[model samples]
Target: MNRREFLKKTAVSAAATSLLAWPNEVWAGGTVNLTILHTNDMHSRIDPFPNDGRTNGGLGGMARRATLINQIRQQEKNVLLLDSGDIFQGTPYFNFFGGELEYKLMTQMRYDATTFGNHDFDNGLAGLQRQLPNAGFSFLSANYDFSNTILKNQFQPYQVFEKEGIKIGVFGLGIELAGLVDKKNYGATVYLDPGQRAADMVKQLREKENCNLVICLSHLGYKYENAKIDDRKLAQQVPGIDLILGGHTHTFMEAPEKINRTNGHETLINQVGWAGINLGRMDFTFSKKSKQKINVAAAVLPIGKTVISS
Candidate 1:
């Protein structure tokens, strides 16, 4: 469909409300709302800041984020929590416990999936390997070959989640680890082209896995002036990706950026910045009759001191 047609369809489908209860029947076939909650590059800030007059002081602790996520889970019938990358490094917590604490806490938060970041190798291959089992969630990295390394059997390429009858496929695409990451830390792990990996994995998820929605958890940042393959570039080059939750640039976006794919399909790219400064929420509604996704509404929730009310 063209952009104008899609917009008209969005509006038309949105008006398919039930008179009896409204809001519940927003699609021709009853609609199922899937709430996607995401974050990126949370670098081990276990505790909130010390209220040093900085706006973000005492804002991004795991406690606050957990409470917020729990509240959303309670309210939303179908919710998927995901993180892009850079789950390790930054604070003294990483310096002290390696990546154990971060993974453990993410397990507590019930993160469905995540991707790898360069900083995850801060403690070297041994460090990430040591804390792998502590993570309750699976890491979905389509690229980053761990065939002959300690991380060989630790990660998966993608994950499929059945939420409220919507088959959601979540995949990960890591940036090139060679030039940016130290060889000593990365060991013999091979890095493939993210563009190719995205095309391949997204195709599999869309065609083979039969996922209704495909999301790419990318650590390639946003746009770059230096001709880097960021999320914007990925959206244009790769096909069949419905959404891209990005990281590595630490960009705090208020809403999703809509990009047109090669097939002229809309692709949404969103990022919540680093340090858990915001929570990116995208609500997708799927049709019960046709079982097709009909509409999407997106907004970013900023994480201020009061988000937790602690």
Candidate 2:
């Protein structure tokens, strides 16, 4: 969908009321609302795009995004700021600073967690490890085994977050790096099968951890015409993931698409465009009576001067 249509369908003023059709009784019976804000492939576009007559001109700036996030935080009680990956490469900021600025800025934003994109390996494992101290949040990667590399024990396979007595399980998955990345850059970072890893993660998160909501921070592309294991395929193959926030292909989805799983469950997949043009938001309400059951609403907030004024 185009930007105009997307904004029309998911207007910022109407997002909270229109996304989900749950009744008032759900909120009256001790329902907890969790707001998830996500971004992906923000390849060092710290400043707003130049107003050079391009389609993306005058859109996307970290400061503007921060303003929007702060606005939301003031209004919402439980909020999670996350990224899907590819936090490096694209602009001269990465070339000069080597991801230090990116990490520092995301730290300032209080990002809860993030996954790895193939470009994250551009500077090799050591470069990534060197800048880890600047980040205060966690890095989650379920499929990439970092045992043999310098990143061993640096990332968790999955993390469980408890907010207002609700357990939210979050995990990360990266695309295969061997073919997409330089061998020297991603040396010894063994890539595992994402489908098997996702199944294992879901089982552990649901059965053992007893998580109320399961989310996957996936760097897998949204969908591929070929037989690649993209987010759509992963959602179809795995039954328990409630949501997949995706990246890598830089797809600008008009809205989250629902994929039916084999076990009669539905997984929602969402991806904003690259370069921090949009911030993806998903609100989930869980009742005390049924913590495992949830009602979700999604919106894509465009970051710009107009948005700040609105």
Clashing pairs in 1: none
lDDT of 1 by residue, 119-158 (tens): 9887899988889889899899898999999888778899
How would you encode candidate 2's per-residue C-alpha lDDT over 91-182 as one tens digit per residue?
99999999999999999999999999999998999989988999889999999999999888889999999888899999999999977899
Would you give me the overall lDDT of model 1? 0.81
TM-score to true structure, per model: 0.89, 0.92
Write down the RMSD of all candidates, one decimal each.
6.6, 3.8
Residue 93 of model 1 has an lDDT of: 87
